[model samples]
Target: MQLPDGLDVGLYPIEGFTNPEEQPEGNGFFITSRYARNGITFGDKYNRAKADSIQAQFSSLYYGNYELDVSSEEKTPVDFSAYKERVADSINFVIEVARKYEERDLKLLNKPMETKAEFNRKHEYILKDYPNAFVNYDYRGYTVYINSGKRLYHFWGRNAKDSGEKSQTTEMQVRKSEPEVLSLLNRFRPRKLYEVPTEQGFCLPYGFIAGDSGHEPRNIGITYRLQNHPDVTIFFQDLGMKPKAGKEDDLNEKDYVIWLWNWQYQWSAVSKELIKPKWRSIEMDGRKGVGTFVKSVYKDGGLNYGYVAYVQGDRQARNLKPDLLLYVMQDSRQARGNPPMDKDELEKLAEHIVSSIKRR
Candidate 1:
C-alpha cells in the first residue's frame, strides 16, 4: 500500500504477536492465526531471519518518518493501530508504575510521614498492653517510650527492623513539681538584719531602706551609749577588737573611743596617713541630736566607713536600755582577704539578730 509522504508502511508491523505470553501480559489479543495457535513456529533458521528482517525494515522506516516529522515541525498524533492499542497502553502503565515506585521510595528514604491518628492508635495499643509506657516525641524523627520498670525504647521505620528499639536504659526518678522548687526558694529568702561585731562595736543591722550612706546605707553600723549602764558595758566588751597599741589612753573618752573604734575597723587609707573626724549636730524641736563627721582618709582615698551616734528619746529609748543597750556597726570589708559571706548566709545571720533583738 502507498503510505503517506511523512509515514511508512514498514513502521506498521503485521498485526500479530511472536509470542502468545506477551499479549496476555498486557491483557490483550492479536488478530492473526499465528497468534491464536497453540505454538506456531515456521522453522528455527527461517523465523530468526524473518524476525531480523522485520526489525531492520521497521527501524529504517521509523527513523525516516521521525526525521521528516522533526524537520517539518509537524504535529502528528501517534498511531498505535498496527499493534493492539492495549500494548501501547500497557507500556504506559509500566512507566507510570515505575515513576510512582521511585517517588514513594524517595519519600520513605527521607522523613517518613507521622500522622497524629497513627500515633494515637499506636499509643492506645501500647497503653492496653503495657499500661505504663511514657510516650514522647522529639524533633529528630522518632517517638520515645519508657515503661515503669524497663528501659527507654523508640519506634522508627516501616517494619520490624525499624520498630521498638531500646535507645537508653536507666533507673528513673520522679520529677518534682514547680511548687516544690518554689518552697525551697522561699525557705532561702533574704533576712532583714545582719550583725558582725568581731571588730569591736562594729555591728550591722541591715535591711531594705532608701537613701544615701549619709542617711542610711543599705549596709551600715551604729554606735551608741546608755546612761546608768556600767554592767551593760560588759556585753559590748565581749566583742573582740584588734587593739591600737599606745592609743588606749587617747580613746578613754566615750566619744573618742567610739570614733577611734569605728575608724580602726571601718576606715581604709588609700594614699593618706589618717582619716580626720568631724562632728555635726542635728536639732528637732530645739532638742540637740549628734552625728559623726565622715570624709576620705586622703584627697584620693575613698570613704571606707562612717559612724553615727545619737541618744533615743524616752519612748524610743526603752528597748536598748536596761535589757540590751545595743549598737550595730557594718562595713563591706572582707576580713584579712577572706571572701565576703554569701547573701544566703548573711541573710540567715540577719534574721537571727533581728529575732534576738525583738525577744529582748
Candidate 2:
C-alpha cells in the first residue's frame, strides 16, 4: 500500500492545516516540518495539568503520545488596522483570563497573590516579532493567544499560575511560581493548534482528499485502500466511550468494539452478539492485541460487518485521551444496499493493514 502524502506520525507541539477553512477536502491534514510542533519532547521538563474546565479538558501537548483535538473556523477578512486592535485585545484577553484564574485560586487557598502581570506576558510573547512568522521554543515556553489575520491560535503550556511571581528559569511552572515535578495541576497550553486538546489531535490521509471527511470528530471520512481497492473503511475515534464497571480508566479492544457496536446500532433493536466472552488473538505493529470480527443483523434485518481491536501492550483507549486504538474496522452497515465484505477478504485486508502498521 502506498503511503499518503502526509502520514500523521504526530511529532509536534501544535499541528493542523495552515488554513483549514481554505484548504478544502483532505489537503489540510498534511503536516510538513513547517507545521510540526516538536516542542519539549516528553521527559522530565514535560508536564500536564488536571484539566478542570472545558478549555483545559480539550488540550493537546507533546508527552509520550500525540493526541490533539481538531477544529476549524472561518475568519472574517479584516484590514491590518482593525486586525492589530483585535490581536492586542486577544493578548489582553489571555492575560485577563490568566489573572482571573490565579485570583480565584488564591482566594480558594487563602494565599496572597498579585493578579497583575499582563505586561510581563507581552514581553514573554515578544509581540514585536509578530507580522513576521511563527515562534517556537523548547526553552522559555510562552502561552499566549494569537490572531494571525487568517487563523486563530491559542497556546498555554507550563505557565505561571500567579502572574506576580518571577522565574529565572525557563520551564514548566506550578500552582505558584516555582518549578516542581510533573503534575497535571499545571495546565498545558490553551495549548493546542487548530482545534484539538493538548493530547488528543488527529489528521487525515492525503489520499482521502477526494471525498473523505476532512476532520470531524465523529465518523471521520473514508479513503481509498489503494489504486485498485476502492474503499477500506476507517472508523476513527478520539475518546467518547466509557469502560464497563468503573474499575478501569480505559477500555480494551473487546470493550471498545462492543461500545461502538451498541452506540452505532443501538437503535436497531436486537440482542446483538459480540465476540466478547473471548476475543481472538491478533498482532499489530509487532504488538499483541485481542481482536474480533463478525457479521450481525439488526432487528430491522440490516446487515453489518465490523472488526474492532486495541493494541495489547500499548495504552488502551482512554475515556479522556487518545491512545493505541488499532482496529481496521471493516464495517459496511452504512449506505443502504451494500453487501457485507466477505470474511476471507476481510481477513486478508486486516492482515495487509496490520502488517503495514509501523512506528514512523
Candidate 3:
C-alpha cells in the first residue's frame, strides 16, 4: 500500500505473538499510538497481505504497538475473545484514526500526547514519591504510568484519586473548555504577496522570485490600507469564509485565497493551547516553529478560521529584532464546499513558501 507523502508504516512485534507458530492461528491483538485515550485495541484474523514483515520493524514514529494483556486489567477486565468482538465492531473508527494519524491530525480527536517535559511538569509531585515511575501511554484522557522496570501500568490525569495495588491512577471527570479566538489577524492592516521575499525578514534573501504572479504581493484592496510599521512591513490577506451582506471585497469561499502574513521582529513564545488541539511545535534550520489549525464559530452566524504554519529565527542584524514570522490563513469550510485547501495541504504550501526566507 502506498503511504502518504510524509508517512511510513512500521511492523511492530507483538510480544508472545512474535512467532507465527506461537500465535493463535489468525487471532492477534493490536493497538494504535492513541490506544490510551481512544480506547482502540483491535483484534482480528491476521491477513498475510497486511503483514509486511515477520521480524517487526520500527518504521514509523507516529505508530507502534505491542501485544496487549487485556486479561490483567483490574478495572472492568475484558477477556481476549470479547475484546476481539469490540475491535470488529469499531473497525471503521479504527481505520479512520489510523488515516488521520498518518495525516498528522490525531490531536483533533484527543489532546496531543504529552511530551516528556509536559508529563514531568504535571506529575512532579507524584514522581517525587515514585522516582522510578515513567509514562507509558495517555489512554482515555489519563496518563498511564509504568515503573522503571515496565512491569506495571497506572493511569493518572487531572485527579489522581484512585489508587491501585501496584497501580497508582488518578480518576476524575474533566471537560476541556473551548479555546477563545486569537483575534490577532483582525489587528493587522492586510496586504498580499505572491513573490517570495527578496530581502531580509522571512523570505529568500537576494533570490529570484518564485510562484505565479497572481500569488505575488498586491493590495488586499484600497479600503484596507496597509499599515506601515516603523521597523517592518506587514503583509496579509483577509481570510473570511463568506463576505458580509454588503461588503463586496471581503474574501469568500470561491476566491481560493490563502492569506500569508510575513513580519519580522524579536520573537516571543507563542502559547500552543491558544490555537487548538491540533497544533504542534516544529523546528527548521535550528529555529523554533509552530503549526496548527484554527476554527471559530460566531453565534451571529459568521465563521473565521484557518491553518497556521510559521517559523521564527534570529538571523538578522544585532540592533534589529532578528525574528521572522510567516503565517498563512485559509478560509474555513463554507456552505458551498470544503475550503480551497485542507489543513494538511495548506500547511505544506505555507512551509514551502516560508522555505524561501534566508538570513542576510
Candidate 4:
C-alpha cells in the first residue's frame, strides 16, 4: 500500500498488525490464535496478542532483548513457548502503555482537551479574585494558572516522568503559594537549550521551540525567539566531508559542506516544496560555510515565533543527510510551548530546515 511521503520504507516490514482479526497487513509476519474458549473471543485474543507483539518489537528496538531480560523481574526459561509468551506479554504491556500514551498525546494535541469555552467563563471567578491569574495549557497535558503577568501559579496533571507511562489523574496543584502571579513564573524553565553556530560570526542559544508529546521527550523543529538577532539552528548533521569546490568566498550559495557519504545518497530525497522563501545562506564562524533559513510566525496579532535552520560539517565519515534528518525532525518542535505553531508554520519550518542543506 502507498504510505505517507518521508515514512521510512524500511520500517514497513516492522509495522506489525493493526488489529488481531485481520491478517498482518504488511510485509511482517505475525501469529494469531483462533481458540474461542473460557469466554475468550478470537478477536479479543488476537488484539491482545498483536498489541503484545508490537510492544515486544518496540521493547526490542529500544531496550535490547538482553537489556529487557536483565531489567525484568520475572526470570523464566528461554524455551520456544516460554520465549514466545514472554515476548507476547511484553507486547501486551506495551499496547496497554500505548493506549494511555495516545490519550495523553491527544490531550497535548488539543490543549485543555475536555474543558471548552466554559473554561473562559468558569475561569472568570478565579480571575476576579486573582485578576492577573489566568489558565493556559501546560506542556500539552495539564492546566496551569498564571497570575499577575505571565507567572505560572498552579498546575494539574499526572507526573509521568519516572514512569514511562502516564500517571493516574491528580488534582490541581499550586506551582507556588503566592496569590501573586509573577512569583510563580520563575519556576518553569526551558527543558532543552540549543546553541546554533552560524557563518554570520555569532553563536546564539535558540530559545523555546516545540516538542512531541507522543514520542515522550523529543523536541521537533524547535522555534526560538530571535535574541537581539536572527540566527540559524541545525537540526540534522551528516558526518563525512566532501571535497571543497573552491575557496570559501568563491563557494556559490547553492554549494554546501556535506558528509561525503550522504552527498552520494541521502540528500537527494528530502522534499523542498514546503520550504519558505525567507530562507538564505550565511557564513559560519568566518571559516566554514553553512546554509541558513528563517520563518516568522504571528500569533495573537503579533509576530511571536521564528524558526532557524543551519548546517555544518566536520571532516569525518558518518551517516547524515538533510532528507533523512527531516524525516526524524518533522514534528519535534511542538514540545516547547502551548498554543503551538499552526500547521502552515510547521510546514514552512520543516521545508526550510530540509532545503537549507546543499551539495558541494
Candidate 5:
C-alpha cells in the first residue's frame, strides 16, 4: 500500500504475513504488511474514528475511469469499462492507525506557546529514545529534529518537512522587523542655528535649521551628519586631526576637511536635463572660493533653486583644514511653492556662511 506525502507514517514490507500489524513501538510510526495482501487492519495506535476518516479520504481518490477487482489479492487491475470507474478499493489499504497518533502530534507541534512544559511533553520521549537525535534551531521561528543515521527528520512550522533526511544543520539569524522611516523622520525636530564646536575648529551656519546629527568620533577624524532643508543632508568630516596607530611616522602636515551637501528635491533624474550647473569664482574673508548654482523645473511641476560654495580658510587650523564648504539649497515644493531666495540670493547666503567659519 502506498501512502501520501506528509502523512507522517512509515511503511515496512513483510515477506510472508497476509495482514498488517501496527508496531508503533518497534522503530517508527510503523506498519508491517504482507507482500500480497488486499486489505489492512489498524493497530492500537489509531482509534476507530481516526481510521475511518483516513479510509474515507483514501477511498474517495479512486472514483473515476477504471474498474476495481477484489478477487486478485496481488494488485488491482485497471480495466477501462463503459462504467469508467477507477477504484483502489480492492488493490490494498494502508492501515490508518498512524492517523490517530498524528492528531496528538499536531497538537504538540502547533502549541500556542513554545514553553519548556510543552516541549518536554512532546519531545522528551523522542530525545530519550533516540540518543543520537539532534534538534536544530531556526531563529526565524521554527525548529527541526534530525534523527540518527541522517535518515529521518521533522520540522515544526506551517510548512513542515514531515519526512526527510538532512546532512547537517544550517545556522540562521533571527529576522527582525524594522522601524518605519517616517517615524524616524518625525522624531527629528528643527533647531536654531548654533555654533557646532569640534575638536578641530568651530563653525556656524547663518539662519539655518538643524535636525538630528548622527556623529561618530574615530581614531583618525570625526564624522557627522546634520539634517537640513526638507531632504538635504549636510555632512562634515575632519581628517589628519586625531592620533592613531600608524601616524607615528606620518609627518605630512596638510590636513583635509570636507562638507558634502546632498539635495533631495521632489524631482526625478529627468530634471537634470532642464537644470544646468553654473560655476563661478568668488572670495570670502580674504580667502578664494568657488560657487555653483542650479535651477530647474521639477518633475512634480515645482521649481528648485540652490547654490554651493567651497571656501578656502584664511589659515589652516591644527585640528581642521585649509578649506570649508557651504550650501544653501531649497526648492519651491519644500517651501510650499514660495521660495524666499533666488539663485543669486542663495549664492550670497552660501558665501556668507562659508566666510563666517571661525578657527579658534
Candidate 6:
C-alpha cells in the first residue's frame, strides 16, 4: 500500500501467484523492479517476521557490508540439524564463495564511468574493490530454501547498518576482509586429503600444502603451494600434459622428471644456462622410483631447486596404472639464505619426504 521511499525506483504490485492453487489476496505478495528499460521480478509469501529490514537489503545505502534476509520456503520442513551442518560448511567454503562474488561485485557494484570528454585519458572504473569479509556481507550472509538442501543467492548490498565501519579495519585488502569473523575452529579446518591420481595407495603430501589462498597450478591434477612460501610448490601432475610453456616432452617413463622440468623451468625466467640433473633412484616397499634434488639459476641471477620423482617400479619398467610421485620446488626468493628455509633445510626436507614413501 506504500511506495518504498527507501528504494531508488518505484515498485508496483504486479503478480497473482507462482503457485497454481486457488488462494486469497493474503497468500503472497508480488512486485517488479525496473531500472531504465530492464527489470526483475520480486515475490514473497504474505508471511514473514516483522523485525527484518526488507528494502535496506536490496536497495542501495551507505557503505559497509551487512546481512539481510530473503524469503525462503521449505519443501519438507526446517531441519535444525541440517541447518547447523550448512553453517559449519560455510567456514570452509566462504572464501571460495566470496572470491566468486568479488569477481561479480567488482563488475556490478563498480560500474565503469561513461566518458564524454578526456579525463586523464584513462577510462575510469571507480570502486574497483570492496571489503569481501563475510561479516561485511551480512546481508544474505547464508540462507536455504525452506527444508531444501541449499539455495545459493547471489551476494549483494552493503554491511547491515554499517556495523563493519566501527571496527575500522585497514588490515586486509577489500577482497581479503570479504569474509571476516571466522572462529578459531574456522581457522583450523582440517587439512584435506588428496590421493595420488596414480593407482598407488599412498596419498599425496596434501597435509603440507596450504589452502588455495594463492598460487593455483593451472593443471588438471591437484596443485598446491605453501602459504608462507609462494615459491615452494607441489604437484600431482597429470602425466603427459603440456606445461604452461606449451612444450611437451615425449618420453613416457620420464613423467616425474618432466612434470617438474616442464611446469616451473619451462617458464621464461629460468635461464638457458645448464645445471646437469643428478637423479638418484629410490626404492620403497618393493617398488623403485627416481628422485632428483638439483638447483637451477634464473636468467635474473636468482636460484631455484626442484625435487621430483616417480614410482613405476624400476626406471626402465614400462609398468603403468599405479604411478606414484614425489615432488618439491622452490624459487630463489624463498630459497635465499636470508630466510629460515635455506638450501640445506630444503634438501633435508626433500630427502625425508621422498624417503618416507611406502606401499599403501
Candidate number of the best TM-score: 2
Q: Candidate 4: where is the Cα deviation over 4 Å?
A: 1-281, 290-312, 315-360
Off by over 4 Å in 3: 1-279, 284-286, 300-302, 309-321, 331-340
Q: Residue 21 in model 4: shift from native, Å?
A: 14
Which model, 2 or 4, shows the larger TM-score? 2
lDDT of 1 by residue, 67-91 (tens): 1000111133222232223333443
Per-model lDDT: 0.25, 0.37, 0.27, 0.27, 0.30, 0.35
Model 3, range 78-158, lDDT digits (tens) per residue?
233433333344444454444445445444455465455543333322111123322222112333222212122232333
Residue 158 local lDDT, model 4: 33
Q: By the lDDT metric, which is better: model 4 or model 5?
A: 5
Q: Pick the candidate with the highest lDDT.
A: 2
Error of 6 at 113 (Å): 38
Model 2 regions lying over 4 Å from their true place: 1-89, 93-125, 128-132, 136-232, 235-270, 275-278, 296-300, 314-323, 330-347
lDDT of candidate 5 over 120-193, digit per residue (tens): 32232111112322222222223222221212222232222323223211222112111211222233221223
Order of candidates by lDDT, top first? 2, 6, 5, 3, 4, 1
Report residue 139 deviation for candidate 5 (angstroms).
26
Put the candidates in TM-score order, highest first: 2, 6, 5, 3, 4, 1
Per-candidate RMSD vs. true structure?
43.1, 14.2, 24.6, 22.6, 29.8, 23.7
- 1 or 6: which has the higher TM-score? 6
- Model 2 Cα lDDT, one tens digit per residue, 156-270: 4443234444552233322222221222123222232223232333333210112112222221222222212222243322232332233125555567656656664332545
TM-score of each: 0.18, 0.42, 0.22, 0.20, 0.28, 0.34
Give the CA lDDT, 0 to 100, for residue 328 in model 6: 59
Superposition TM-score, candidate 3 onto the true structure: 0.22
